[model samples]
Target: MAKITYIEFTGEEHVLDLEIGTSIMQGAVDNSVQGITADCGGACSCATCHVYVEPEWLNKLGDKSEMEEILLEEVCQPQANSRLSCQLKVSADLDGMIVRLPESQF
Candidate 1:
């Protein structure tokens, strides 16, 4: 399992143990973690699951897909490091990934 540390804009942090090969959105949803709405399930259609990859961990995550890149623009506060959690598949190399939640999910 990969350990994902999620931090909110307010600096609140929560760690979740995600099964390998599962998407970040699924990990959050399965654990009922707050801040990840995942309105579109794991299809990468909705930006509600948006999160900002911490600078140190950005290079460790998967590259953004064309679909995810398009949807990120609609997220609350898109940043260069922004990604849809649904697009981030957990892996052994990403064990200590840290993602920051936006202030809003709309």
Candidate 2:
């Protein structure tokens, strides 16, 4: 399992030990973390699970897919580090990874 930290816009933090292969979005939704809405689940069809991966961890994640890139373009506060949580799968390499939620998902 990988330990991931999700920080809300308000500075609230939720740290979870997610099993390998689980998406970051799944960890938040399953644990009732407040920032990620995940309206479309892990389908990558919605931007509700948008997050900003901490700069130090950016190189550890995979490149965003075409669908993810398009969806991110429509989310609030898109940044160079912006990512769709559902597009990120957990793994040993991601242990201690930190992601910051946007002020709004809509």
Best candidate according to lDDT: 2
Candidate 2, residue 55: CA error in Å? Answer: 0.6
Model 2, residue pairs in steric clash: none
RMSD of 1: 1.1
Local lDDT at 98 for model 2: 96
lDDT of each: 0.87, 0.95
Worst 10 residues of 1 by lDDT: 69-78
Please give, for residues 6-104, the per-residue lDDT of candidate 1 as tens digits.
887788888988889999888888877788999888887888999988888888876888898888878777888988989889999999989988889
**Model 1: lDDT to the true structure:** 0.87
Q: In candidate 1, which residue pairs clash?
A: none
Score every model by TM-score: 0.93, 0.98
Global lDDT of model 2: 0.95
Over 16-62, each residue of candidate 2 has an lDDT whose tens digit, in order, gives 99999999999999999988999998999989999999999999988
Error of 1 at 27 (Å): 0.8
